[model samples]
Target: MMERRAYPLRISAVVLDAMQRWSEDELRSLNAQIEFVLRDALRRSGRLRPPPADPMDDTDGD
Candidate 1:
């Protein structure tokens, strides 16, 4: 089963508009485009290294 997470993100109007245009042009969902961009940014910024053996952390689970 896939786990769901939520985050608060702040973005500039110009960047948001660009993302909207890019998503419409590519016929991709807004959520998908945003996720793709975020993943690319994380990789480029070296924030995401190799995946852990278990990708999910259950410490937050009840």
Candidate 2:
């Protein structure tokens, strides 16, 4: 397992509200949804490699 670190983040209420809405749309936890968005942006910017397929995507085909 990869080591995970927890750090406090300060975000505006409006941004947090938007993230909450987006998380519900994607059926993901709010924190996971934020991470997903950040990872995608990183990959697009060439700062990170593409991530593995999302397990959540499989649910829609069932």
Candidate 3:
């Protein structure tokens, strides 16, 4: 499992409320939703590389 680090964030109330609503709609916790959004943005901007596929997760016939 990937390890997580705690970091304090100071976000505007308006944005926080919007993100909370979005998280509820997606059935995800606020922290997960925020990380998902950040990861997506980083990948889209070519600032983050996709994690290597886990060999143990392979299910296709080989």
The Cα error of candidate 2 at residue 57, in Å, is 22
Query: What lDDT tens digits, residue by residue, belong to model 1 across residues 1-62?
Result: 54669887788999989999999998998778998887899999999776656656667676
Best by TM-score: 3
Range of the 10 consecutive residues with the lowest summed lDDT in candidate 1: 50-59
In TM-score terms, candidate 3 sits at: 0.81
Off by over 4 Å in 1: 8-10, 52-62
Better of 1 and 3 by TM-score: 3
TM-score for model 1? 0.58
Judging by lDDT, tell me the better candidate of 1 and 2: 2
Report the Cα lDDT for residue 42, model 1.
Answer: 94
TM-score of 2: 0.74
Clashes of 1: 0
Candidate 3 per-residue C-alpha lDDT over 1-62 given as tens digits, one digit per residue, 9 for 90 to 100: 87789999999999999999999999999999999999999999999977889989967976
Which of 1 and 3 is ahead in lDDT? 3
Per-residue alpha-carbon lDDT of candidate 2 for residues 10-60, written as tens digits (9 for 90 to 100): 999999999999999999999899889988898899999655777667767
